[model samples]
Target: MEAKAFDTRLFKRILKYTKPYKFRYYGVILFAVSLSVFAALRPYLLKQTVDEYIKPKDEYGLLFYVTIMGVVLILETFSSFFFVYWANLLGQDIIKDIRIKLFKHMLSFRTKYFDNTPVGQLVTRSVSDIEQIARIFSQGLFMIISDMLKMVVVLIFMFYMNWRLTWIVILAMPILVYITRIFQRKMQIAFEEVRNQVANMNTFVQERVTGMKIVQLFNREAIEYEKFKEINQKHNKAWIKTIFYNSIFFPIADIISSLTLGAVVLYGGFHILDGDKFTTFGDLFSYTMFIGMLFNPLRQIADKFNEMQMGMIAANRVFDILDSDKDVQLDGAKTANHFQGNIRFENVRFGYIENEEVLKGINLDVKKGETIAIVGATGAGKSTIINLLNRFYEINSGAIYVDNQNINDFKLESLRTQIAIVLQDVFLFADTIHNNITLNNAEITREEVIEAAKKIGVHKFIKSLPGGYDYDVKERGVMLSSGQRQLIAFLRAYVSNPSILILDEATSSIDTYSEELIQKATKKITKGRTSIIIAHRLATIVNSDKIIVMDKGQIVEEGTHQDLVTKEKGYYKNLYDSQFAVDLN
Candidate 1:
């Protein structure tokens, strides 16, 4: 669709949020219309008071007009306050609604979507772009309406008071408007570039901050700074364009306004001097006031037009996210309320990117309560299997089943609730250990959390910490050691007690002592549940009931640890020999 300064389609969509705030919406409209009338009436009243009372030196008449003018001023003040209040209130509420919808929409997207998208770009859409959209109501759309209405009323008064003086001001308008139109479009284009650079800057900063450790570890501080400097330069240049337009436009607007006001006064004064008693001093005063009122709004309308343009640009970008559904994780209406954890993959084929399959056509099955171990070198699609089992990404072609029922036939939440995973890189929110373990699940009581931690054998270790279970793990659990974070993650997954558990190198990040503890905990947890263990360290999965060796997205071997190792040239045997110096016996 062709875009414009006043995007009708975008405007209608933004207005949809006002549905719930109809009271405030109507309040703004009423005040905008009423305030215009009140503002216009003041100059006419001043003309009347000056000509009818102040001119005659009539004491009672002057007192009466002064009292009425005071009341009008009081009323105008109240109306102005209400108008601004309702407009801002409406804007704030609408943005809150839009932000919530945006967040919820993002929640529906699959992990593949997040993998391909930058974290900072999403943050820009959620916060920065939405903020620009809010200006549509608060400082752009409603303000423009109020100013335009005032302009119309002032023009009516100008024509009534003196048409000839009105013509003087009117003649100067076309030039200002023509320039404003050009300025508005320029600002729109500049603002779009500004938004793009802002998003790029956000993406770079977010990635750098999140990986600050790596930057410092690898002595990349200077290099990253140089790269960021380049991005920052682009960001500044983009903003300067918008600022340059504003710097040029507003001054030109002010000059035109001054010239127009001066022309009205000069014309009015000359006519009055020419014995044109019809153009009285009162008429001249009102014409000057009328020019100020009319020209001021014209300049303001031009400024607000830019604000609305920026807002429309932001809305268009944000709507791109809102209207997206293709990447949203599909869920069925039927719930997997009684899944048996009997997982099966039949010739699954999938890829993170088009034409680049990460998992080739493969088939596998795990019976209920069966423990299987998958081992492979890095990039052998070890983690991809876990991702597929949990349905984090949609397969290009495949069928996955639990208890002989297709995974697609079950609700996403219902299916996921029955399974849990502990990753190599565990993420812990900045919260107390108890909250992180329970995940604020109200149904899981404190006693259950304590019991689960004890089962994982981290209960005493946690109790030894500064605050025991109440200890606050700072952002990403940085306050805790890597082993401690891994322990917390293990505890978190155990507390949920899903029917299926997948541990992806769960013990790889831990110290020797923690690994021993986790091994013991692992055995206890996997005793009677379906478990899939992905490991780089071959020693960790030596006792698995079945071992699967994968290479390059395809499973190459599958058998018990003893059975796989007995083969001299098996993939599992080769991986085991490389990981261990001792004989396979």
Candidate 2:
């Protein structure tokens, strides 16, 4: 598909949400139309009361005229209120529906999308943009309709009362229309600038707040503040431009209206004084009253048009998110069946980005209940191996199989549910210790949590805290040490009791004491399951059933610990010797 800056296709797609609320939308439209009719009728009724009843100079005529005026006021008030409520409700509901779709669509996007885009930009689109669109839908849209209907009705009444005076009002309209068109063009540019500035400012705030610790650690507070000042200045400039245009809009429009109103009054007054068939004081009064209202509606409608334009810009931004494609989806509609824990990767090639393969044409297999260790230098595609097995990213070539079926043929959820990964950089949610460990799954019993914790030996350290498992970990497990966080992550993964377990340097963050405890836990956890252990320390994988040494994107050696060491010039032997040599030094 060709890249579109704003998908016009989204408007039709978004109409699906309006389907459920069609009745409410219809009710709002009916009330709005009804309100417009009432508004249009009132001026004609006022003209009648002033010319026919009030001019007769009878006591009964004055009383009847005042009664008609009071009734018209009451009816207009009711209709105005009638439409406002449902119109607001419609806007709120549509906004809620659009926001939900955008949020869900964002979740379905590829990991690469998130990796490249800032979180703040996404958040701004979800919130501020939706709000702007809602305001236009609710207030601006209805007001524009009401004003246009009222203007049309008033023009007909103006011509009925006197064609000559109506012509005066008509002549001024083209000037008003020309000015409004020019103002709208300028406002659109101003509004777009404002939206872009807001997104940039949001990005600045999100990055600075999230990485505050890093900023402080590097002692770059002054530099960070300067950067923020630059963004803030840009935001202010956009706002000022919008305000400057606004400042001109009302004054210029008002001057035109005032000049037109003065001409109507001046010409009508002369006709009334000359005792000509051209005028009466009542006619002059009604003409000026109608002319005054003419430009009043125009001013409101023009301002609403500006608001609608701003909202369209925001809606376009929000729809961009809703239109993104889903990167990974389930297939074959199969439930995850139990496996014999056999895993084989047959000459798989993969990359984070196209043409930049991280794992190139490699094959490996692990037997049921056996532990396979992978060791290599940093950036040797070791972590990529675990990611492929977990199906976090799809391979570019070849296939990975569990039992006999290709992994891609299985449902994504089914494939992932069978595998558990403990990454080197463990992330813990900010919540109670128990919630973080159990991940709020009601199915996991306290006994299961305790068992995993005890097996990992973090249970004792957790108990030492004031609230034990109920203790709050603060943000990103910041309250606990890195080793403590890693231990809890291990417990979290093991508690799931997955058929395949991956420990990617799980104990590397821990101290000597925690390492020994975790090593023991690792052995217990890997038993009776297919496990892949990626480690930097040679001692950690010394007793694995098989060891694979990786270099660049290919596996260079595979054998048992001693067998690999016995091969004097092999990759695994070289790695093992270098580690011991560092210890001896």
Candidate 3:
């Protein structure tokens, strides 16, 4: 995408997030203005002390003025503290809200969005990118405004003191401004590169760490480390570019500021030598101090401007996600409460990619309380059927009905609530096993959860683990074996008391003992619910009411296991023979 200029519309949209905390935001602005005013008064007070009291050698009067200066300093300190504290608090609060909103928005997206996008990129957005936005509030926008206000107030006081010197100070500003503009443009590009490289590095590390076993198993750690080094080098180079621009810009600003100060002293010295009454010694001293104050804020503003640019870029990325139309459709008005388990797919055709169908005009009818087993080679659209039933992806052209009503007419949440699925690979949160099972559903009480686990026959296994049901699964259930995780998934699905249960090769990778327990649990769970089993192991599903044989996204044969096995040239018989023929011999 082409880089966009600072967008006012995007800024206004970001500002809308502060609406709930407008009072705090406004208070920050108030403190910023107060700080600027206090800062501006310091030099003016110093000028008065020098010209009015010090010139006459009035010790007591000088002490009184000095005391007032001390008082101003204390007040200024308080103002500075309040400004920094509230500004940061406001930034933190705003970003916190934005992160939550961003995460919730992501949850509404279709599964296809996640399939195409990297998880690390999303992580960067929610964490680092949002943090950059906080800098906009804390160190970028408000600080820039405060600095500018201080400079403005200083300029006004300077002109009031001596317009001739003030005009000289003003003359050198264009040079600093010109240099800063160049720095701004260059730093913007550099910062953009830095952000991009950070995201790239994050994606690389996340994927590698998650798949470290594969990397080590294949002995490719050295190769992967070299790749990481290259990405890290690029990230370093991008930051160095920003540093280079800053090095050039700040020095130029300092030089210009110094030359301006020298010019003021030269002019005042000549006036004093000529016995000019208007250019007092105190005036020169105060102007020098004001000049220093002026240049400092100008230099800081340039840096803060760069920070603001980075924030804008981050906001743009965040808005891109929020503005996307790829979210799952949720416009269905009918609720799926008390839906019968009857399901039918009428000429269902779907594809993850255009012009490449995964499920080609499929038609299937499943009655309530029937256990149907679907068997097929990989890529035969067996799993696709379950995905479509759950509406994870929208079918390109087809109609799916539950209980004779179109599935699309049912509310997405209500439709999904009635179904439970256990995939070949299970996912568990870094939470207690009880939370994973009940998913923190208050409706499912602790006793009810234990009862469900007991019914599924995995209660003993869960109890054997340290902390039993309260065991912390740790990230992705790394603390547990595959079979143990799968058993937890079974308990989780069972406790929901879903109207439809789907086990898509859920028993594929478990041990024989776990498989036996799963088989018993499966029989109990599917007793009165509509269940769909997609299995490669035909033995596990032989007693199913119907066995469907699929090839190339089409159902080739379906019948009772006994009836299908009787066919001499049947697909099911061939599949059964391939595995059990040796046993028969």
Give the true-structure RMSD of model 1: 1.8
TM for every model, in the order presented, reads 0.97, 0.92, 0.97
lDDT of each: 0.88, 0.81, 0.90
Q: Candidate 1: how many backbone clashes?
A: 0
List, residue by residue over 294-398, the lDDT tens digit for candidate 3. 999999988998888999889889888878875655558998887669999999999999999999889999999999999989999999999999989899998
Per-residue lDDT over 1-585 for candidate 2, one digit per residue giving the tens place of the 0 to 100 score = 222323345545545656878987777677666666666666667677777777776668768877876787788788778678877787789899888878877765656678778999998999999998877657677778778877887887788878887888889988888888777778778788899999999998998898899999999899999999999999999989878887988898889888888888888888878877766676677776687668888877778877777777888788777766556333546666676789999999998978998899989988999999999999999998887776667688999988867887777677777888887787888898899888898999888898778777778898999899999998889999888888888888888888889999987888888788788888888889989999998898889999999999999999999889999898888888889999899
Question: Which TM-score value belongs to model 3?
Answer: 0.97
Q: Which stretches of candidate 1 lie over 4 Å from their true place?
A: 1-3, 582-585
Per-residue alpha-carbon lDDT of candidate 1 for residues 440-462, written as tens digits (9 for 90 to 100): 98999999988888887889999
Q: What's model 2's TM-score?
A: 0.92
Listed per candidate, the RMSD to the true structure in angstroms reads 1.8, 3.0, 1.5
As a whole number from 0 to 100, the lDDT of residue 564 in candidate 3 is 95
